[model samples]
Target chain A: MGEFRMPSLGADMAAGTLVAWRKQPGDVVHRGDIIAEVETDKGVIEVEVFDEGVVETLLVAVNAKVPVGTPLASIASAGSIAAVPSAPSPVQAPPPAAARVHATPLARTVAKALGVDVTKVHGTGDGGVIVRADVDRAAAEVTSTPRPDRMRQAIAAAMTRSKREIPHFYLAHTVDLGPALTWLSARNEARSVTDRVLPGALFVRAVARAARAVPELNAHWTGESAPPLPYVHVGVAVALRGGGLVAPAIHDTDTLDVDGVMRAMADLVDRARGLKLTATEMGEATITVTSLGDRGVEVNVPVIVPPQVAIVGFGKVVDRPWVVAGVVVPRPVVTISLAADHRVTDGHRAGRFLASVVAFLEDPEKP
Target chain B: MKREDIEAVVIQKLAKAAPGTDPGSLDRDEAYRDALDLDSMDFLRFVDALHEALGVDVPEAHYPKILTIRACTAYLEAVLAKR
Candidate 1:
């Protein structure tokens, strides 16, 4: 039998609460099947099972909080004699509702005072247990805010650790978007409104291509050494409508064209805002790209998210005076900035990476 | 469709585009992009939602004319009237 453990969804994630289980004992599970939903500081992530087997036992109960590496379930290998038939005979029917409801003492007191059913109020606390605030929110019937405070705390913890541990070197290059815009306009004019690609897609594709050319930039910083990832999974930083942000990976980004990037981005953004991202999408970023699209910010100096060695930032594209062939002329321009870990790469390598990005953006037609 | 109906459709699409945001809180005259912190992709999605709901294809050139709730309603009104 193999154990399915609670996955570390990010460098910052320490523990996650088991919100719900998609599979019960005796259910056949595939290698990539989402077995459970885990709630972390980032949000509720759909956790996938890497082992294809029949679930023998669910070690963790729904709403139980477990640390990274804790075994959540056991699975019998596929075709094994222990693999029960499709009809699920749960080894353990989830503990009775009375016994399953985990809540803090304060929460119980508050729920009693407010005449709220403690069992009915979903817990946002550790291990899916109810806390005092949850009781109060239930009492007041406020459902609009979805734990933005916990998300903010998560961001704070990650960013704080990043700034403290990672010695970052920053570089910026201004790329003329005149060529790109003209190319995009011509390409978009022929397409329907829904099919048209945005400049942001071009930016992501350029970053992916540049990362492929300069592989070192697409790597993770283990304390001992920096290793380049085999594939470029470029994480796009998406701001949540509920007040935080998540940088989920667009898997194998280097293989996608601009239109593919656009479609991927649209789907990713929709799922991200819905808080339905998978565990791999949450954790496996080789590099990240962030943009302040059309908000008029000319540049941004980003901080590297730990484990990932580099992050690329793009500012708003605007009109600027350009010197073309020794003559000054108006041109659309955007500033691309890179924040890389100094421990892994130097300014020279960082500069070359930025140059590659510039080259790709300047000649967008090149596959 | 009536102008009010167009406005309701715009609000519904906006809510769909930026899921967690409150459509009722949006200022009719204020730019939806700025108010909702919507990036270019989100705005495109809002436009796409409008297209799906109303069968109105908003061209790229006319994006600026529909940045606000009031503006979007008026633009859709003009387009639907012509249709």
Candidate 2:
């Protein structure tokens, strides 16, 4: 592409505002054809197109303020359409996202949040893999959310490091589980509902269901090294029923079901209450789920917990007024937070994952 | 370093800095653009490498004066003399 900058039509012209662009973006123009009109310091001047081809980009618009030499329009070469030139390529790059099989959850979040497109962000770690620090550094370059609370502080440190060093982004869903919970309750009542399906277990089950649908969400960040293991570990944050919070996760939540999540949630909550959590439980988690609001959150951006590239928060389930078919009805609402590393996942992918989570929560009767 | 040695090092280092094309057979008389077919980035890379190699501070004000190969030789000689 060739840049057509605002020129000093006369010696009197030091700067000129763009009065209008006669040719819009992608409009074809031949050499010497006037592409735009500029109001010069002396008079209105017609800026001519230099090369022939389609107008690839117009940096300034009609009534737009501009300076001399400020690139106003760009034309493609002979028969060449000016595509947004990919930012000058950084030396070595990553392979495609589809080819990426196993990365740590934390690494994935870090990558997605950073908008680095994990598939393209070449991994320097062992086995051609991308790591936590890569995502951390990338996140730091973007949104630097500083220290606030203990979990928030730990999360900030982890994310700051993730953004600074790693890359990540997330998709999310504000789910409403009143209907699903009602269904579970109805089934329980019909069968003399003994175990009151803990809301956290339900939330975990919802996570498992959605993850199974999108295996990409169930992935782990494979560290900086290449040739690494390619599976996702599921992290579940448990608010100790008595005091404090215990978020020991159920590794590989994608492979498990509601029943498995129930057992794991029970075990973790028990251990967490007694302060019996281990280092592996704390450090090795690829994803973290905090059910501060029980089923989901009101609104949240869960911090990516270091090596784990994704952290999802489930807020409290509340009964509120809702609209359905133009009628006001008392219904339940749930919100979830999907704070991820922006480097790998775009907002669109993260939005889809969140939608999947919402879809699973809305009508969860499954095989 | 001799003037020829300095110029050779600058050209060689510039080629590796951007990772693609090299400083195409430059000489004291050749214009920088005509010699290497360089764009702005290539020139910037050359300046950065030159600064790194010689451990001297050069600023943007020197760009217009030292853009050509002959001009670069003159600028380096003057800087070396001053140091």
Candidate 3:
């Protein structure tokens, strides 16, 4: 029998509340099937099972807060039910006072606004008190409005840890995107509105390809050593509507074509805003790319997300005067900035990585 | 399509693009992107939804013409009338 534990969705995630179980006892399960919904600081993540088997028992009750690595379920290997022992007792008891309506003032107000019953909502806050986010989750079953207060706290924790632990160095390079925009427009003209690619996808693809060329930037810094990651799962930072943001990964970004990157990016943004991201997408980024698209910011010096040694930032694409063949001309340009862990790589290597990105963006069709 | 019908489609798509935003609260003449705090991707999805709903092809060059509900209705009505 194999035990399925509560996954650590990110370095900032310490515990998650079990929102619901998708699998039941005696159900046949396969690897990669979503088994549960876990509520974390990021939002409710669809947790997937890695072991293929028959679910023997659910060891955690819904609404119970489970720490990372705590077993939440048991799965028996296929056709080995007779050899396996009986289901183990639940790892945690459900929170007390299921009938009692204990909620924060903000939660009560939100519940009233959203037309959700305070008593019916599960409280995941301290001492099993319902919070505003809990009421939002109860109202919208599949998606919830992330409580700005909680999200801000989460961001504060992660960013503070990053600033404290990671010695960061910043680099900036300006790339002319005139050729890329011209090419993209021509390519998009032939496709349907839904199928058309965006310059954002080109940026992500360029960053992924650049990471492949500079493997040192695509790595996790684990204290004594920073080993390069084999795959490039580029996290795209998406700003949420209400407040806060999430950077979910597009797995194997380096291998995907521009079209694939666009599709993946669109889907990730949709899900990230909807609060329906999966655990792998939440946790498996080897590097991150943040863009302040059309926000009119010329440049941003980003902070590194912990463990990941590097982050690439893109500012608004704007028309600027450029000298070409000794002549000044208007061209669309964007500033690409890199924030990397100084301990892992120096400015020389980071400059080369930024150059590779510029080259890819300048000649997108070739990459 | 009638202007009301087109307006409904825009509102429906806008709701999907930015969930939790109340359609009833939207100012018809205000730029929806600013009103809804939608990013470029969300706006693109809104356009994609408009295409799927109305069979209208909104070129990238014409994005500014549909920035608000009032503007989108006018644009769609013109496109649909031509069709």
Q: Which candidate is the best by TM-score?
A: 3
Residue-level lDDT tens digits of model 2 in A86-203 = 3432212223434463444446533433334444445567886667676665555655543223333343454476677655554445555778877766654443112334556667
Question: Which should have the higher DockQ, number 1 or number 2?
Answer: 1
Error of 1 at A179 (Å): 1.2
TM-score quality measure for candidate 3: 0.88
Q: Provide DockQ values for all models, in the order shown.
A: 0.71, 0.01, 0.72
lDDT (tens digit, per residue) of candidate 3 on B16-81: 888878664778898788778788888888898889899998999899899989999999999999
Model 2 regions lying over 4 Å from their true place: A1-172, A190-194, A222-230, A239-246, A278-280, A294-297, B1-83
Candidate with the greatest DockQ versus the true structure: 3
Model 2 chain A: which ten-residue window has the lowest total lDDT? A86-95
Comparing 1 and 2 by TM-score, which wins? 1
Report how large a share of the reference interface contacts model 3 reproduces: 0.58
| TM agreement with the true structure for every prediction | 0.87, 0.42, 0.88
Score candidate 1 by lDDT: 0.86
Count of backbone collisions within predicted model 3: 0
